[model samples]
Target: MNIQNIEPKYEILLDTICKTYETGKIKAFNAVNTELVQTYWEIGKYIVEFEQNGAKKAEYGKALLEQLSRDLSIKYGKGFSRSNLFQIRAFYTKFPKIQTVSGKLSWSHIVELIKVSDDTEREFYEKQAVIENWSVRELKRQKDSGLFLRLGVGKDKKEVLTLAKSGQIIDKPKDILKNPYIFEFLKIPEPYHIAETQLESLLCDNLQSFLLELGRGFTFVGRQYKITLNNIHYKVDLVFYHRILRCFVLIDLKINEVRHQDIGQMNMYLGYFANEENIEGDNPPIGIILSKEKDELLVEYATYGMNSQLFVQQYQFYLPNKDELREEIESVLRGDNEIII
Candidate 1:
């Protein structure tokens, strides 16, 4: 009967009601999205079948789509633009088997996916999108950033196919590495002088976006994470725990090319984390020396036969150039060894 005492109980009741409502809403939305995508696929199939059967439609090509778009808009009222119709048609063409189209994705997601020209690249994006539960915008960003090409580069056809099927299996330290990890979302101007502290601050400020760029299962632990050895002070620029890998990821940033000393330091950090930071059931930590560049030969020698799971990779302030990325992928595929990592 007391108003003050009843407030907490009412709030709890409201919270439970809202939670139950949201669960039902999500299920309804997913069911609706699945139905819409199936309908679009059926429409696309009908158009294709008509095109095959009708001489006028077969001859006119896009003319048929234009007419269909106008007619469908008259009946449905909206969302039947010629461009969208063409997209729906392409979706069916790309995924001829309706079973292959994921019920998890909305029509908006499919619209972005059908634009990919390469089968392998498209499959990679599709599988990752579903597995990662990426939004349509996120899907577009990954496609534009050439994530598939980045992973596929420096590998043979078999490896590329495996990657497409597996969707970034992080079994080892190197599995999590991306050469020239993209931080364009940080909006740091190129050719501008910035200290490693500033870069680390920016990344921390944009941690959510950074985690997405870093790929799945990374949970940020801290920035400038400290690990003292024999009273000597040492700091890692960023520290993260990979849920899947079951290890701590220690990152050190360098504005310039990585040197032998950086490699040695990373090796030390890995040792300290493995021995001191890691508890039972935790794997040996991974150390990534993130820099603007790395001298491959020097790194190769510095890490020779020494096993501490240390890796050196570059970071770019901006997006990797598409033309250069394409050229590099092609070169690597053609047995060209010019671009090392």
Candidate 2:
């Protein structure tokens, strides 16, 4: 035991043992987590059942939870606070059929989903969470950014329903689009007027968060992806490959309102990528012009005759107005406006 010199195979043996130990720990933790979630669901179910059988349902509402919280805390120790119990109860109420609940999501993720009052919106996030394995924090950010609305607004009603039921499916170029892409994670400074190059650099610095905001199936190709046509050179601000769509996505950043010339520039980039960059099995490239401001009329005309698949969207430095967006979505659902994309 005291020998200073170790055998050649000793390190390998120790490494294998360490890996096995870590793997076992992870498996055990997951098993415990699953059981814990199931137990919470049962508790919620029992609470609801008890209230139904009570003489006065109102008596079993607040008072029942308060007494249960005190008793559970005293007997089982922490994690049974009134707020936590409320969440547990709501979890059951929201998802009565335990079979429908996702086994992939953690309790924290479920808590965040429970806060989403809209049934369709909550279902979208739940399915997306299970499919994408989004962390609790990521789920919160997406909800705050009004991802459901972004995907559903101005989109076909049936497609929106499918998206809600099955998370996001990238069947076509527009499936990956998010209007007014949120970049609050970049944390731009006081003046809030960052140059295009500066914005690109900040995006790189926060690449992970940026990719999450970008949605599913995007892999970074390169920054300042260059293309040369007839001795003149141009750079796309960001280049990403969509694994699902099997296409190249080129994005350009603009600090000012997007001009018609900017739209033409992105079309050129897409043309270059489609003809010159695409491989034998690759699909046509898609271009996105992300600007600080855009005129719907201007963009409509700028992209009117373009052959290459191009999109003009806004990029805000901060989170969007969630309440306003939510109201818009509610209005749409109520048949106030039937806008199509």
Candidate 3:
């Protein structure tokens, strides 16, 4: 046997062995995660049942959790703190139906969720986490950043409750809009000046994080997409297609404050897409103008008469403070009430 030929065979054998071992490890990790989640769910059910049938006492609940934690930790060896047991109890109280929790979310995700007091907010986070396949950290970030409160603003109480309980319904255009979109992934400095080119490039580079920021159903298409109308060439900053809406999404980038002209330009781009690029049976294309600043009045005036679907939204390079964002959202809802009054 030639030494050179033997080297190739040895490398190939090593590679196969390594890959097979890695695959087995991955499967084992997944199985462990699934089992952990199931155990937590069962623990939650037991806690709820104990409160209902056995204890029926507040102090007893605490004592029972401590005792249970000690016993479970001795047998299971880890992940059975008294606080965690309480969290499991709260989890059952919040989501009595196990069927509602998608298998995509693990026990760690539910532990973070159990902290939310509002049932609607809890459900919204749960559904969004499941649908988005959000990591445990992402779930915590969204909750801490007040994503549910921000998205729930401007909606009626019933609508808010429905969205919180069942997640956003994609039946209407407004359903896609997320007020104060979470941008924790960006990690940009606060009050920093960013160019449109820079923003577009960053988003394109971190397309997965950008899609999560853009809410759901968005699949990246391309950047600087060229189109022609009457021999006049125009370029859209970014283009995406939404699977749920079944339409092309034309995104225009704006660095400075958004003006009526920006919205108008986006409308024109959307109109061109609807008439030219959109295929038969495809929904009319939607245009989104992403700017550092957007005036609500300007957006309303620009989109008032246009048959084309257009939206002007402000983009932040960094995540907003949770307390401030929550308050802002609440204030917006109050302003809506005043307008109604």
Candidate 4:
């Protein structure tokens, strides 16, 4: 048979093969996600029941898990380790309510949530992970890097807890700001050379993780979103619509340290969105400047008395040492002590 004469038949076969491959891939992905999530839910149920039934037996839960692990590993195989069982127990304790676990997050994400000691912080990260569709690795890095503590440190405990349990309920503008945004998902080195364009590109490439770090309800609208004021064109680094907040989230990325001018620019962006794009029933647009560093005094002065909603937050390309972040939190708490002479 001449090769050229067979070309049409070969092309049809190739197209069918590609279609079948894609269908199989989709089915496999769904199967794996469903299996992992269901397993975690069952583990949570067992742990909760074990604790309730055997409260008088000091080592009952541990012994039960050990025997169950051995039996399950022998019969079914992988992911039945003693440590994983402990994680499942912790998962139940952390999120007792089934409704709290969103379908988008897998058991792997829940495993990362087990490491968070603070219940409020754990809930916040979990909700954000599901809402933003964060990968398990991204979830782990964000939790380990102290993202929640950094955001919730100065906030009222009750209000912060409410946000964690429910989700971003932005009754006030300040509620939308996370003081120090974690960007370890980009896998960039800290204190390394990088430009604004590079940062913007990395964020857009990993926009899902960026949204997770930003918190819940953020939907990516565009990058370098263009706007014009009086014939002058300006581009916002990233644009998002926050479903829960019912407003646009205009993010401006800065490579160098933040300045008053950055805040002014963000305020202008917010004003434009409010006046030009805001619709009925929509709240005022929120502006955030994500920079390498920020001066607290400068941010206070720049945002003070300005009605337009604006925030200045620092972003770290690398995960800081966990101990270092904890120590810093302790130092800040101590500094807040009002010393009586």
Candidate 5:
């Protein structure tokens, strides 16, 4: 009887209807995407089988893709270009088993994946893309950033292969750590100097890229997190909670090379966190001292036999040559030393 009250009810009903319709449309789109990928794979298989057959083997030469594209486009209208057919063929070659294909990932995502030549590396990227819910652009960013190569640098050949086959496994504080963390996304130029505060500010400004560089399961907590002990105050540069590790990560930034005092300071931070911040269910907090450079011998001697979970690693403002970094990592592995955490 009351028009105004009834109008509110109608609005609610309309909202629900629109949401349900949108949800259904999304479901339909996902189903169609999955089916389209499956269709492409089947078509690729057919083409491969035709070429393998004695009669059609020679016919499927240089002009095979062009002929197929023309005929398919003539029948089906569009989306069957030579490039697409080539991609479809490559897709099949990359993932021959349909069971391996993820329905959640669209053909656009797989198009980027097919470019990866190594089976383990491809598997790693796919797993990470799904786990991290990376968009097509994000996936491309990871690829261009040489994420797999970055992870493999410090590991032995076997460990590197395992990393590719299986995404990062975070059993310990050391597992998630990377040396010389890349921050080229900040758009900072090479041979430039920036203060620690400015560096922290830039990282916070580009938090998404920073998190991607940090890897999976990390959620931001705060910056300049302050703690007081014995009437003295200290502030941490950045703080993050690692969901998988079940611990708080405290990072301190330095523009210069890491010194023993830096490690000692991180040790103190870890102590404060483990004592004051960690609850009953939480693990001991980990501390990272991020500097532009670290003296390896000093790091080894300083960190050795330290009870606290403190790690010192270098950070780069620009992207280093992947091949050079790869070689550096392999060279370090030859020494059979624990990787710089």
Candidate 6:
């Protein structure tokens, strides 16, 4: 049978058959995964109800779980171990309302989510994971890096509460900003010194994790993205298109504190992108200066009159020092700044 002798119509038919098979396979896989998640959730619910006797009990719960674990392991094999049972029980307790549980997520995803004690924070992660189609590893990375906490910090109590109820909503350019963007996925040691180029390289190597940290709707465009004006050349460290916001996002990385010049250069980048690259359908571009530190007063004064959306944010190579970050957030919210004459 010569392949060249095959009719075009038959070739098209063959392609369609393959596509249909793949679609069916995916649907079957999803259905199986959904049922597995539901079964685990039901088991979790049963364990919780059995342990509840009247109120939450520590010692009684421990004994009950151990006994149940032993009995279930004997009958069902490995999945019903004491640790697994504890995870399941915690899962049911965390999501008391079964309706809130997502069948789209696997047991591994739920295991990661169950560790999040805050209802609001857990809800945010749950919604984001489904919306973003995060893998278990991505979900774990986000949680370990404190994505929710970083977004919640600096916000008022009410705003922070809102974050738990609804995942970060990007209504405006400012709404998309998170201070001290965590880059823990890069695996950079806390004490290590790395240049801007090295940072960009690490980020590109872990692009998926980087985008997830950046939040929803971010699609990478390019690195060292060029802009030319008056025969002078300038390059953005990284560029991304935000599908939701319908705008270009330009990022500049700095190993040290941000300065007035950094803000000015970013403002220029935004202007160039707005005038040169932005088409009729695109929103004005936004710029972010990601540095290790920022002078609050300098950033405030430098960006005061800018029409473009410009933000100076810090980036941590490792997980943030939570207490220090919290203190800084408090100071910013308090509007405390020192004047330098």
lDDT of 2 by residue, 1-341 (tens): 73336577777888899999999998898888888889999999999888888866665688999999999999989999999999999999999988888778788988999999989899999999888889899999899888888777676567778889999988888888897799988877666966789889999999999999999999999999878889998888999999999999999988889899999888888888888889998999988888888999999998898854799888887778877877777776676776557
**Cα TM-score of candidate 4:** 0.67
On residues 1-341, what C-alpha lDDT tens digit does candidate 3 reach at each position? Answer: 66657686887787899999999998888788777777777878977877788767889888888999999999987788998888878877777787777777778887888888756568789888876778998788778767787677667656776777677678756678776565557677867667778878887888887786677888888999998888999889999998899998888888888888777778888888888888977898888787777788877887898854788876666666667655644554456444553
* TM-score quality measure for candidate 1: 0.92
Candidate 2 clash pair list = none
**Per-residue alpha-carbon lDDT of model 5 for 1-341, expressed as tens digits?**
86667576887787899999999999999989999999989988887766666355544544788998999999998999999998988888888898888788999999999998767679889888887788999899888777877777767767876776667777899888876688889999867679999999999999999998998889999999999999999999999999999999999999998889888888988988999899988999988888898899999999889954788888887766877765654554455555656
Model 5: residues with Cα > 4 Å off, grouped in runs: 1-4, 7-12, 54-60, 324-341
Candidate No. with top TM-score: 2
Task: For each candidate, give its TM-score against the true structure.
Answer: 0.92, 0.93, 0.79, 0.67, 0.89, 0.88
Provide the global lDDT of candidate 5 against the true structure: 0.85
Candidate 6, 1-341: lDDT as tens digits: 96647675888878899999999998998899888777877988887777665457688888888899889889978888889888988877888777787778888898899888757678889987887788998888877777777887767756766776767778789878887698877878757688889988999999987887898879999999988989999999999999999999999999998888888899999989999999999999989999888889888888898864888898887787766655654454455643447
User: In model 1, which residue pairs have backbone atoms overlapping below 3 Å?
Assistant: none
lDDT score, residue 28, model 1?
A: 98
Please write out the lDDT profile of model 1 over residues 100-205, one tens digit for every residue.
8778888889989898887877888989999899999889888877888777766675677788876777777777777668888888775858998998999889
The global C-alpha lDDT for each of the candidates, from Candidate 1 onward, is: 0.84, 0.87, 0.78, 0.76, 0.85, 0.83
Report RMSD for candidate 6: 4.4
lDDT of 3 at 223: 97
Error of 4 at 54 (Å): 12
- Model 2 RMSD in Å is 2.5
Question: What's the CA error at residue 91 for candidate 5, in Å?
Answer: 0.6
Best prediction by lDDT:
2
Model 4 error, position 46 (Å): 8.7
Q: Candidate 4 at 171: error in angstroms? A: 4.0
Per-model tally of clashing residue pairs? 0, 0, 0, 0, 0, 0
